[model samples]
Target: MKSTFLILSSKRYNYYFRRFSFDFQNKVIKTKNLFLFLTLLVLSVSVNAQQNQVQQDSTKTEKLDEVLVKAVRVDADSPITHSNVSKEQLAKRNLGQDIPILLNYLPSVVTTSDAGAGIGYTGIRVRGTDATRVNVTINGIPYNDPESQGTFWVNLGDFASSTESLQLQRGVGTSTNGSGAFGASLNLLTDAFSENASAEISNSFGSYNTRKHTIKLSTGLLNNHFEISGRFSKIDSDGYIDRAFTDLKSYFLQGIYKDENTLIKALTFGNYERTYQAWFGLTAEELQENRRQNPYTYENETDNYWQDHYQLHWNERLNSNWSTNLGLNYTKGKGYFEQYKPEESAADFANLIEEDSDVIVRRWLDNNFYVINANVVYKKNTLEVISGISYNTYSGDHFGEVIWGSDLAPNTNIRDRYYEGDATKNDFSVFSKATFKLLEKVTGFVDIQGRFVEYKTNGVNSDLVDFVTDANFNFFNPKVGFTYKPSSSNNYYLSYARANREPNRDDFKAGVTENETLNDIELGWRFYKNKVSVNTNLYYMFYQNQLVLTGELDDVGSPIRATSGKSYRLGLEIDANIQFSKVFNTSTNVALSSNKNQDFNATINGEVVDLGNTNISFSPNLVIGNSLNFNPLENLQVSFLSKYVGEQYMGNIDNEASKLERYFLNDLNINYEIKPNGIFKSIVLSGLVNNIFNKEYVSNGYFGSFDYDDTSSPTGTTTGYYSGYYPQATTNFLVGATLKF
Candidate 1:
């Protein structure tokens, strides 16, 4: 009877294979080889298993979903310095802020918001490294933008509500898909299918007229095989800065199918955001007068964008020793940021008119990205190996149009494009990772990857200059590490990794043609007892041709970068959690670092000056965070969180005028739950008070220098510095309630 059932299943699989082939041939031919290979392997394995008649275990499929991220995530005993955050922990702070703001208290992290509040356009930096160098993945699939290599949290407003878990690996921890991790890697797993049907409604209101509304539902397991879950969220904020407002809408939907040995999921998530411009931060004089002031006065100056994503994942448990995962993704993004230029030169706008004129123009980007990932895992008594291949392609169109202008040229329409450009990129990589027990209490790990990238662009840039580029690069990254567990409560580890990365679109435009490289070494210790856990690590990172920020902003508010010949960072990080008693606990982390640019030279005071071993820009030397929690009642909890960041420079030159002062901030959070036997299962009420002391501070800023002819100087020219600061809100409050049924 088992043989007969196998034969019938084979026939059904063949029919599905035919349909899959048809779709592959027309839609995703570029990645057909790996897809075909995996499919054939699955078929061959199934047919050969008929002779053995292995009984399927339905319980195994419930845990198969974890395989989606098994290839990229690390365990506590692994030779990696990392932290994991669960959905339950995030719920306490799931206000209208972006993901970066919610993760602000993590070890060695700094967060900034452009709207003077945490409601819109937030960014995160790890180990003093910017977001561009921090790789991000969703369920092991790449999430960073291909062209910019940056993660835009504003695009996924209220995404924390849909996340099941997230892990942050500091330093070049492992080899994964998409861009390389020069500083850190973050991967998130979406909500898992629930076992029981449920519905939830959450609403929150905060300062600055901020509010959020969310609706979520889960169909649970239907007939023990199928499940569906979804969420919709809307967020609005009248920001703390003048004229800075945000309106955002986002949704997430997923369908899952599970069986005795297989788990397949299809997901779609996206968001649309309209945010008023606040990137032009205030100068020192303006900040002293009114810290919430915005330099831009145009009423219509705003950024509007919409992005959509589709993902399909299949995980198969081919017995206990072998498994495979295949993932496919498609992302569509389109957007435009409108700007008002006063007295702009015609040459800059493609000679649309022969003279200077005030114009309102829009810059647009339309892009499509596709990815295919496949991996196979083998696990035995004391050995495990994972090998994977990933391929992605991106095509983007860039153009700009003048929507209104004081003067017009002949035969030009209102939406005539002033500049147009297009770009295409293809990235392919293959990697293999293995871990095995070498001794009674020692384990070893090795990871190797080869990556190839091809980038091409054509047409004119926004500066009305003919821009063209065709570049190709190949990189080899290798990592090795070992873990020693002396006892059940103590572990020690050491690791070394090497990574290489190419420049982004802006870097190419700035005449940067060299790739960057990093050599990182890490040593760590971990301890776990009945009521205490501690993790500490030391890291040394050396870089060549590193793309360091130049402390300048382009016309569109994007930061500019220039390559530094040599640089290094040395840091020590320690984090611990202590449960003093049943009702009280504490969590704290501290980071101390020294970041420097060796033999740095800059053009200062009309001469090239060597600033020997200067401090790296925006790299603070000391950062500390702490959380004190109390649970006096069964259903009530209160947490007091605090953070302190030391002073740092905004420019590599170490000029006194470019310094940003140190700041200490504190927040209070409270959560209470009511279990009712009425219509609702439970009601959760939460309140958050930020900057409880009403402290005024600035968290981020920019500085630059320029040389100009000066009659008073001894030389023919002199250099002057200019700076801008982004101020944080003094005091703010957010309160919310959630109903679950």
Candidate 2:
């Protein structure tokens, strides 16, 4: 009966294949071939390795209590380049900054902030890939908005406080849930259960009138079965830029039940944030005149947003060889950025005015996301397998409203919305992966995933343009690799992966764009002995239809991007850590890459001109970061951090005028702990001095072009270029204190 069912399913799929277009049919065939090849390889290896006795020690397996992130996380032995940040490391930098700022020192990472500081809206790029291309997850749940494909750290202010650990995998990582990992993937696991009750209070004050206060309490492991923990935080910052202040509040709560073979957890977390608008950076002239000037002079210009998340997770260890995990998650998000416009057209305002007049308007976004994820794992002897599936739905509404206007009409209401649109999306995917020990020192790995995505939009945009769009996409991603361990202290790995990503809402609005594809190959070597460790990796990624910056800004100040014909990124990454003594250590990481647009062309004077392999925008050729730690006393520690970024272009055109200069920055950090005999169990004090050299630099910028005519000159036509920059703050300091009992 099973054979008959399989035959029927194959026939049905064949019929569907015949009905599809030629290109789609080819894609389906390619996916099938990839699956078949992987299956054959796995089977061949298993047949030869099954004769050897397998190691079935339960101590070698991961515990079920930590299964929340197992669905999307990769093991250390996996053939990937990754970095891990623990809670203790985060606490040292969690004074009053966002998560992106905290992760700025990782390998192949770059971060920027709009408020001249890290307290407000911030952005992160990995391997020159923008936030939109980076896949993010929290407890195995997708964190990026389905439409924008971007993670807004501002909506989760001080989230680092609740994160127990996080992993950053660079370059087409293992298949995971939600959007594909084109450049990188980040997964965060919240605080785990504690065995002892605890209470804590934290406070910090810094430059620009920045301050943060937090309170936390935990009822750890009640009756050895249940536990509850919660935290509340409030942060305020007067940014370095004029009128760029921030006001934010956030909270987190968790309840857990645990036993020998079962674990269930419930979590609720959210944040409310408001900040003055500072989206527009400074032009060259403006930067030289007044570096802190803000274009928006209106006192009430601000962006207000709040987000809430609820998640439930269950993990059951059916037996020593089998374990399963299930997760249900929902997120509610709403926000609006308000602005005051001068000389606005009556037609543009939905005919609210008969002539041009000043008006106050708001662009709002309200969205809800629901997701279900499940994974089952089987481990026996030298073979392990995992099968995972996930489904997600997102509904979002975008609208524009006239809050205040200089009109005389009495019937006009402030609450009336002029433009509104709704967008809905559904994403579903299934994946299977396996690992087997082929030899005493060699392990093989394979992963395959199939995903289906659909997006629909209805209504008009703020520009009154019809955005009735519907798109459907199917993707198959496959990864295979092997790890060879020459000894306990040395290992080498080689891997190749394929990844595909669908266009986001913003990309759709720009124009019709094809899906993006990447073929990445990686080779790495690691060596560890005594107090010294070193890791180096070489990667080459070939891309098709990759989206790149065009040096243009849309109506709402968002950067406009266009798809390129072909591109490639080749790089080498090295990271090392050395312990000089029992109390002194140093860690350094460096990345050097060559990124280019292959056979690039542009239309000039109605003629297609070959640019010939120009540099890709925003991808610096070299990035270096280093840190030194010292323990002068038993309870006091001091550290120094430094970073350097090479010059990079702001647009794919790669004109000399559109380049950002190289920059070097340094920071100093110090922390001290005290254990008193009084009521307080421990007290910690910390301080951070940023930009210790007071160096002035621009971390991000854009370029624009304009056509000009000069009748008096020899040439009657001229193309002019302009550049803008987002400047960083000078030397600043932050002081913090924490009390625990």
Candidate 3:
């Protein structure tokens, strides 16, 4: 068996190697320093557990840490549609890709990458809703940008390594911090403090000149009450697209103190990233000519950004029935994306110069965010109640500077501000939720929240126009649900929830956007027996004044949205896991949905046309994912994964040119572990082959329409459609090894 496995692996490698070209020298040189850094860091932190005092049971600390997120998480029996992912599951494919890409196989999920290889600038959409509407929290603290309401995974490269577990709650699952969840709410729990001293070094190399190096260490529990753990990671990738490259460095450190019923943690994590711009995708002609071509040719066309996050958490268990948690966070972010404009009008750049000339400019965002959260949980025999209050304040400065130009006005100098603006926002919310057993076979759930928000901005925007806004909103959200379990193997649930969200900064700039509201209803069933488990969920979501995507991108590559008077999404999602035998198992999920904008109206050919009952932009009708796993040996595992996305339109007008074709993809993954008796305890090796069939596909794009008038035509005017597409890589592979001591 061993010989056969070896032969198969060799043949597969030979086949792929023959079809691809590798710059071995360049890759080796680029990763040499990373290897050295990992070795030094691991050696310095390596320590023997026998030298330190024995600690309390690690399970106690783990339980206390779990308490930190209890207020925002739901259990399997709850009336919610959610999925939980563990570190073990994530580790199987944690090779250089972003978290969204790693989570691509989940239910109702769609992920895209601008760099084509999932190493930089990734985005995720759930149930036809974009990232801006998806609420994200790290250890129960809001992680989305307060102004844009978007989550930038590039700023936290390789964060999956530090995550112990995560949960994705679809369709306004529960009350959480930050913006309301119109699509989904995701919460991540950081790694728990280890009870024994340990250290690990990991390295991976893949296609497209991609490589990752990570070093992790834990001091274990010192004197039975304290521990220190940290991780440092570096990732580099030359993407499939021309001149698309990413260089990222990140660090995570935490100091923990814990006892039988108390836990205190202080942590800091941050990343510095520099990546060549690739957001401008290909046009139709360009896609057919050379899909990998990039239009931007400037040498320094890049984005440089750094963000640091600080958090402190305290959890105390007063008694069996009462517990409390307090969390504080301070985040500082500063970054800028540089661009070179040719033959640009000087008046468009704050009148910095008198005439149209080629220029180089840098747009910067410097921001500070502060958050305070307090929550308490009470539990008895048949009832559990959680109440929490969160307050956050954000202040950000937006400015642009002209670095160089062919021509300049008198008194104008280098590094002068072209346009400047500032914005501040304050958000406060209080929520109370309870779950209680009402009868022998029934459980009831209720949640209520009150949120208040104030946003203010003043100054000139990049277009040299006065962009000032002062908006305030008050919202009340409520949720009710119930679960019925007639037998241990069967469970049924029904729920209804309401959510309201204020417009983001871009919304205000686009036009007078109103607050959006959602009413969601969910029905679900769970069946588990023996080695098989299945979950089915049906959901209906109705929106009022919803900000739907217009399939257009701003100058900075951000998606543009417009208010839809009324919209609805109805879907059925089913996910299952079945163990057919001791060595073989399978997991599958499918989502079938119908998303539409009622009585949609648009300006076509210089006329307001009522395009009644049109499909919502970027909302696909079918999505399916499946995984087949086989454990040939006790320490070896191999899996095959598949994904299919149905065709979807990119515009509300439903024009043929705005449609994205459906595509299917397959991947192969292998993992093996070896135990040794020497200095290292274990060595693990992993390999992944993505898009195994080498299928060409585009996962995301944009669409727009322009009207032109012609005297020879009867109507005298015509509408033209233009679109851009982001093509994904055909086939790629990543292989990695990890050493634990």
Per-candidate clash tally:
0, 0, 0
lDDT-wise, the better of 1 and 2 is 1
**Positional deviation of 211 in candidate 2, in angstroms?**
0.5
Q: Write the per-residue lDDT of candidate 1 for residues 1-741, one digit (tens) a residue.
A: 544753564464444434332121223433475455345434443443334333543222226777888878887899988999999999999988889889999999998899978988888889999999899999888999988999999999899999999999999988889999989999999998788999999999999999999999999999999999999999999999988999999999999999888999999999999999998898999999999888888898999999999999999999877889999999999999999998888888887754778899999999999999888876655556677888898999999999988987777789999999999988887766766665668887777677778888999999888889988887889898999999999999999999999999999999998999999999999999999999999999999998988778888888888998899999999999999999999999999999999999998778888989988888899999999999999999999999999998888999998899999999999999999999899999999999999999988888998889998887889999999989988899999999999
RMSD in order of candidates: 7.2, 4.6, 15.5
**lDDT leader:** 3
TM-score of candidate 3 against the unseen true structure = 0.91
| Ranking of predictions according to lDDT | 3, 1, 2
**lDDT for 505 (candidate 2):** 89
Clashing pairs in 1: none
Q: What is the lDDT of residue 617 in candidate 1?
A: 85
Q: Which regions of candidate 3 are displaced past 4 Å?
A: 1-62, 713-715
Q: After superposition, how far is residue 464 of candidate 2 from its true place, in Å?
A: 0.5
State the lDDT of candidate 3 residue by residue for 1-741, as single tens digits.
423632553354334323322222232222343233323322221221112213432212126888878878998899989999999999999988999999999999999999999988999999999999999999999999999999999998999999999999999999999899998999999998899999999999999999999999999999999999999999999998988999999999999999988999999999999999999899999999999998889999999999999999999998776788999999999999999998888788766766778899999999999999888776655566677778888999999999998987788999899999999998877676777665568887877776778888999998788999988887878898999999999999999999999999999998855799999999999999999999999999999998999999999999999999999999999999999998999999999999999999998776789999989999999999999999989999999999999999998888999999999999999999999999999999999999999999999999998878877655788888899999999999999999999
Off by over 4 Å in 1: 1-62
The CA lDDT at 413 in model 2 is 83
